[model samples]
Target: MWVDLVVEEILREAPSHRHVVNDAKTPSGHIHVGALRGVLLHDCVTRGLRDAGADVEYIYGFDDYDPMDDLPVYLPRDYERYLGVPFCNVPAPEGGGESYARYYAQEFIDVFTRLGATPGVYWTSDLYRSGRFNEAIRIALDRAQEIREIDREIRGSRGLEGRYPLHVICQQCGRIGTTAVVAWDGREVEYECRPDLVRWAQGCGHRGRTAPFDGHAKLPYRVEWAAKWFVLGVTVEGAGKDHFTRGGTHDVASAFCTRIFGARVPHPIPYEFFLYGGKKMSSSRAVGAFARDLAEAMRPELLRFLMVRPHPRKQIDFDPAGDTIPRLYDEYDRAAEAAQGEAEDRDLARTFYFSRVAGDPPRGFRPRFSKVAFLIQMPTVDARRVLERDKGAPYTAEDERELEQRISDARRWLERFALPPARFTLQAELPEAARALTDAQRQFLRRLAEIVQAEAWEGEPLHTRIHELKEEMGLTPREAFGAIYLIVLGKDSGPQAGWFLATLDREFVMRRLREASAAPASAGE
Candidate 1:
């Protein structure tokens, strides 16, 4: 909602050109799902800008020119030798089809595209190689001292402190981290490739400075942050909360923009990220959910909905290991229905509107997520037929497609993230857990077997019948359900027992219950 407020303010200011919003990330490893937050935030902002009558374009960049700072465990130990090389120049993993940068960058791009955030993708290496960044390099060198002062003033650094804003790839080893610009002669830079400059890679100790042009050298991150705005003329962008802190990269870059480059800095929309299992997601650490993981587990619109429903400032601690998927689907469904009706909360309804995959979302005959997930796992049950009966009508084409997609999503979620409580397999015979039931529980099962043979089966009515039998047989609801689970699911609990049993073949349900009701007799013999 605040994004709307920001876009409205920017609309009033009215940039002279198509409003440019940009986001960039270094493909240091497999891109984490947390990175999607920025992609979604910018999409929402760009849409808001367009709705507010501003011409807008969104560009996403992979900073492949950045040096590899850390290697993930999946890479070979020999990859350490390339640690300080530009990411685009490094080799991709064995069997990966492209350069290291393209491998991971393309994967992440596919993810963003599927999530409905269609951003113009630019690899920084391409910009440099194509000479697009040449002018920005010149600007950085000409304003080197001013840029250094802004950094020093903002970060409270003493002097230059052995830091130069420019890094030249070593002429001998082609490693960027081994060299630092020692002096500039107004044209060529003087530098040394020291062996001990960084821990990841050793330099050849060669000392020579060529013209830092045409992909030869790059500005350090903070300066480049400012350089890109001047080069691309970005008008609206958002950064995570990390960059908006006092004297952080955004502040320093804003200062550089005002004083050195004479360009309007990108408007700031500060947002937080999705945390994974209570910690920050880092691809290099391989500790958080990857974009690929989410792609496999969620439908595209549902994945987009996860990011859209939360306010930009709130932290989402997602545990993919839990029931967050089904719960999210339930919440998303409620929001979709509210959006369809005359509504009280317009912002929430607007969120549901934009959260769709594309075009109109499915309408009519939507099944509950939990129920769909439950029925898909049962081999003997035709879930579609059951769902149709439950709906009291056949599903429309769109509803059938939605049901199939939900089945795929539920299967993926079960395979990857289902906890013990969410899992159950139908028994081949009565389980030993059923043999331990008391005589009254066994009698309830025998009576339930008769009901299974006689009652017209459906979720609600059978559920009511179970309750009635619970009262008639003087059994607690838990006790009554426990017998069904132990006999059919081999546990003391499972999916809502009546609906679960209703989904199975009538003969199978009757036979399983009858076998369970007799388990104690065989045990005594």
Candidate 2:
């Protein structure tokens, strides 16, 4: 399994240090399908590692404590009373949960659970409150000199030099720019922020200058993160592509772990964004048509199958149309049929889709009735006549009941969950022959009705009827028997017509047939 590959890589690189997947948050916001993809990827890795005989731990961190300018004071103006509080400490729904840090963390966790991904959560505020991970933060800060040198070495070795800042995080305050200089063991290091760097927000009427860039400001953030992973000792983690962009927190964490706390960087798998209606998935906006939305419309298994293929890096374009769902399932079925003797990748893909489809029927799987043939079977037609005429067995009451319930449920599920029901309607007109007098199609329909009216219904009698009709009409068994489908459904085929008609109320079916037979042909002819 790929998890084994990751574990082997980690063990080879750092045999003594524990392995962990560092799951971090991008500010608390709406959960998107893209985020769900990250969760699934992480699950794959975690499951893979355990299968490979390696111990794995999961650590999901809330970066809510990180400084965020993107948020505004949505609450009443006197918000300073909330300062020094973590993001979770903020207010409820109205404030974007930005009133406190704890509130921010819980909101997204709720969203994640809805998508079927749960992580071992460690809040940054809890770390600060407990003051337990402080030692790791202090050590990483004390070694800021060495960490910077290593960073510079790595950058220079790669023949690229960029402006890199030297700073340590403050455990007391959550800021990253504390610059107080403290010397220990013949090494000079910054233990706090540079008061000189404090400046007012550009063009803002707010008078107070910003706090200086202090190392202590970040101590709380880094120590809490590094310490959580160190103790949890996780093996795999996944994140959205947002955090991996060129220079991001991953780099900072790498330096903190390798140079400071001396732990191995866990395998980081970055996933591409999941688009909704061709746009990047966004939590704050409408969910549009993604996995969760689709799950509501179809079966859970179908949604899972949707993500089974296409590597993590590959992009997906999904449509909510019911037609697309069946096609996708067909593809999944094809993969399953061809899975034997195929490569492991192919087998896994098949297994993945199979499990997803088998998991839960979305809203409820419905038959593909939108097709012209399916429409034809919707009415009560000469199905019995066709069956008797063609020597097919008649249907038992139980069989009839079951088939009727299936059809009714299918129609209901489609009506309830399908988007824009009008789009799937087939309103085209029938041919003049089918519309005017008894088309050969109508004749067969009438034949089935007669047999239903004549005998005690049973599977055998229906089969016998279809066979008889096939012989008399000189039509292939399929061609001869298909007329019943056309007569009942106003189309060429549908759920086995004889069985369908038997299950359905006879009067309803007869009335529908009368209506269909008398109806005039439309432009669709």
lDDT (CA) for every model shown?
0.83, 0.49
> Candidate 1 — what's its lDDT?
0.83
Question: Which portions of model 2 show Cα errors greater than 4 Å?
Answer: 1-19, 71-85, 94-118, 145-234, 245-252, 282-302, 321-324, 327-350, 353-525
lDDT of 2 by residue, 321-361 (tens): 54565466555444544454333465554445333422332
Q: What TM-score does each of the candidates earn?
A: 0.92, 0.57
Error of 1 at 503 (Å): 2.8
Per-residue lDDT of candidate 1, residues 1-525 (tens digit): 566777777776775458999998999888999999899888888887877677889999899999987889889888988978999889998768578999998899989888888989998888887888888788878777777788889987644445557889888888887787887777788888888877777777889878888888888887788888889889888888999989988998898887888988877788887898888988788787898888777888888888877888998888877688999998888777778874567776777866876667657566888888898888887889878877888788877988998888888888888886578898887776776898888899999998988898777788889889999988887788888888888888888777777788888888888877874666457
- TM-score for candidate 1, residues paired by index: 0.92
How many angstroms is residue 322 displaced in model 2 relative to the true structure, after the best TM-score fit?
4.3
Candidate 1 — worst ten consecutive residues by lDDT sum? 156-165
